[model samples]
Target: MTVDSSIMISFSTASKEYDNQTALRDITFMVEKGEMVFITGPSGSGKTTLLKLIYSAERPDSGHISVAGWDINNLKESTIPLLRRHIGVVFQDFRLLANRNIFDNVAMALRIRGAAEREIKTKVYESLKSVGLRHKSDSYPRNLSGGEQQRVVIARATVAEPNLLLADEPTGNLDADTAEGVMRIFKNINAKGTTIMIATHNKELYRNTGKKVIRLDSGNLVDVGKG
Candidate 1:
């Protein structure tokens, strides 16, 4: 297939296996820049594995995967960090450092990239404000409610303005109202031209978002539709 400049993510015959179990099978798809697509299916349908491939946490077993023009399948170990700088991943469980306050947690990404202290402070504050968590910037993760913690994770993921945003069940732990609020934040980020691919089982959230949906089942990609 000819690679399109507009395509930010592409997978060709990609598969992942653990011993005898195959998590993904011959998966192929393209995610264009600035598009929002949902990966939806029952549990264990390879949604998370697909996201992991994009994020370079795992390599495909048999095929090629590319993200933001970087060939993840053949990426050098030293370059993985550089590749991840262009992608933001939000996990089902908010991966916040328990001891760190919200500002420090959100600033960690920039810090790792060697951003100056003044820049980190400004960017971290702006990120927290975007999530409406500016007041809680000094609070530890343990002190925040589940919804609040998730917002902090979101803030951290987007603070650097990544080119691609991968959210795996981002709203899974929230109540309906809180989930809606989080969805709105995702929408706002997408509006700013960031590519968004969300893995979720929440049918209502998918329907309400009105974005293209990519369904998967038992390691097979189903179809794109308005789920």
Candidate 2:
């Protein structure tokens, strides 16, 4: 497929290594603006590693990596946070603050970015509503179910309206029904024009969603398949 000039993510010959083990091998791909794509593979197939590269948590050992036009491979330490503002990331582990309530946790991103109090309140509420967790606004993370906590994490990741959403096993901990619901929320967000790259092992989930699929095996990108 021809990559559009309006691409939001681009990785050319990207690779990552840890000591003697290679996490990714000469991988190359592009996610265009407003596209929803799935990244699937078995465990240790470099799905998480690919997400990390886009999020700037890990740099490529060789080759180029760019997101939203910024050169991630050459991005400076101080500019990492700046780059992250344009990308939302959801992890298998919901990284919510144990001490904070749902509203506070989701609003934390806006607070760090110095959003006004009124804007933060409005945006946080809307974000929570999108994930069907507005009713749990005052509840603590520990008091919520696994799916609820994951929803909160999703709200936090998307509250700022990021250009790209990188989700790694987002539905890994949810039940079948709940996972379907979460995937719908993701689809809704993607439909609104944000680019989405979901790394999952659930082929059924991707198939049901009808998004473009990119399969990986042992760090190599295999093929782009239809859902």
Candidate 3:
């Protein structure tokens, strides 16, 4: 198969199984750089598994997968952290530190990257500001609303400006309006050139948005088109 320079994520005949059940089968798709794509399916249709593969949390049992130009099908365990440096992931559960303030939570990303304290301050503030949460930098996760906590998570994920952002049911715990607010933040980030892929079962999130939708059913690719 021809590799396109603009492709940011590629899955070629990838298959994965756990125990006796298949999570994905012969999956082949590509997400272009700077594009926003959605993966949709039912409760256990492998939506989350697909995102895990891209995040390097799970490896394919067969075929090949690539992200940001790196071949990850056989990616070494020691280099997984290096691969993750170029990718940011948001989960359904807001994994914030209750003991740490919002600022510290976001700073953790830069800290892990060995960024200087001065640089961390500047970038964390910028990221929080981008998500419209700079004012809550001093607040703890429990003190914030559900939507606010999710925004803090977004701030944390994008603090290092990763080239690719992957989200798994990011808005699952929010109301309709709050979910849209989070999505708008994603759109703004993608406008600046980061590739994004969101896995969700909520059709309301992608309806009328005109973004590419890849649907899965029983680990099979069932549909691919504009949402």
Candidate 4:
């Protein structure tokens, strides 16, 4: 397959196996820079596995994977950290530190990248504002509601303005209203040109979004079309 210059992620017939179980099978697709894509499937359908490959949590047993123009299929362990700096991740459960305040949690990403204290403060506040959580900067994660904590997680992930954001069931645990609110934050971030790929079971979130949809079934690509 031809690689497009604007492609931010490309999987060329990649396959991955966990022991005797196959997680993905010859998955070939490309995600353009700044595009928002959704992966949907039933339980154990490889949605999480695909996202793991892009972020280097797992490697394919065959074929190739390229992310941000880097040949990550064979990427060195030493360079994994370098690649992750440009990527952000959110999970079904909020992974914030209970001991840290909201501001500190959001600032952790920048601090890990060796950002200056003044700069980290500025960027963290801006990210919090974008997620509509600036008022809770001093509150701990345990003190906020589930939706509020998830928003804090989003703020933490985007504090550095990553090129790609991968979310796995980000709103899976929230109510309908809260889930819609979280998805709106994702749409707003995508509007700013950050590429986003979400693996979710909530079909309602993608119904009217007009985003690209990728369906996986039994480790195979069953469908690829726009919503």
Candidate 5:
């Protein structure tokens, strides 16, 4: 594929290794601005490792990764927060704080950036509303169902209005119906022109989405096409 000048993500021969195991091998691809893409593979196929490399959670052992024009392979520790502010990440596990209320949980993203109290409140509620969870603002994670908590996690991740969002097996824990609902929320977010990359092993999630798919096998890029 020909990479455009405005590509939001670009990987050139990127590779990552942990101990003796290679999580990724010479992976290369580019995602244009505002594009939605899926990284599909089976368990232990390095889907999670790819997401981690993009978000700077894990560095590549060789090659390059650039996100929103920032070179992740050479990313500095002090600048990680700045890089993350423009990128949102959703984990398979909800990763919500059990002690915090839904509102605070979502608001935390804005708060860490020194946003004003009023702005934080507005953004948090707006994000919650997007996930259909505004009414549960006062509830804790323990009080919500699995799907609801995942939605809250989504809300928190996106409340910062990131330029790119990376989700690793977002629907892995939800039932089919609930997973569909989560997918809809992602679609709505994508409609607003925010780029999204979802890592999922479930074929049902992208069966008819028509989004671009990057298929991985044994840490290698096997195919790139429509879903």
Candidate 6:
């Protein structure tokens, strides 16, 4: 199939398998630029695997996959970092550095990209302000509440202004109110034109959002439509 610039991600009959089990099977889908999409299912339904594929952490066993018009199936190792610059990932676990304060943690991405210190500081604060956490920049991750820690993760992920964001159960650890607050931050990010895809087994995360939801079951595409 021809690559379309507007399609931020595309899986043309892609499939992935682990030794004894299939994680995804002949899945075909597309996510357009600036859209927020959800991938939901029960436990072990390939939600995480799907996100890994997009992030290039894992590769599909068959068929094709592309992100922002780059053919993932044919991507070179040297080019992976370049592709990743356009994507931000929020892991299920808070992968914060124990020794670093919030400001340092949020500055890590920019530092790795060789951004100037002044530029890093500016972008990092803007990101933290966007997530309502600029006041907590001096605090350590261990001292913050779970919701606050998650907000820090969001700030760090968005500091580089990626074109796309992938979150794996972003609110899995929070109470309902905190989850709603985090969801609000995500919506604001999407409103600013970043394409987002969130993977969750929690139906409450997707229900009533009215965006598109892709459901998977035992490695099969069960449904693809509005949440």
- Which 10-residue window in model 1 sums to the lowest lDDT? 203-212
How many clashing residue pairs appear in each of the predictions shown?
0, 0, 0, 0, 0, 0
lDDT, candidate 6, at 22 = 94
Query: How do all the candidates rank in terms of lDDT, highest first?
Result: 3, 5, 6, 1, 4, 2
Steric clash pairs (candidate 5): none
Candidate 5 global TM-score: 0.97
lDDT of 1: 0.91
TM-score of each: 0.97, 0.96, 0.97, 0.96, 0.97, 0.97
Which lDDT tens digits does candidate 4 get at residues 1-227? 45677999999899998988989999988899999999999989999999989999898999899998778877999999889999999966677888999999999999999999999999999999988999999999989998898899899888999999999998888999999899999999999999999998789989978899999987888888887
Candidate 2 structure, TM-score to reference: 0.96
Return the lDDT, model 6, position 32: 99
> Candidate 6 residues 19-95, lDDT tens each?
96899999999999999999988889999999989989888899999998889998899988888888988988979
**Cα displacement (Å) at residue 225, model 4:** 1.0
**What tens-digit string does per-residue lDDT give for candidate 2 at 81-111?**
9999998888778789999999999999899
* Candidate 5 local lDDT, 1-227, one digit each (tens): 34456899999999999997989999999999899999999998999999999989999999889989898877899999999999988988878988999999999889989999999999999999999999999999999998999999999999999999999899988999999999999999999999999999999988887989999998999999998
Which regions of candidate 5 fall more than 4 Å away from where they truly are? 1-5
Give per-residue CA lDDT, model 1, range 6-119, as digits (tens): 999999989999887999999888889999999999999999999999998999999888889898878999999999999888888888999898899999989988999999
RMSD of 3: 1.2
Candidate 1 vs 4: which has more TM-score: 1
Per-residue error at 197 for model 3, in Å? 0.3
Off by over 4 Å in 1: none
Error of 4 at 133 (Å): 1.1
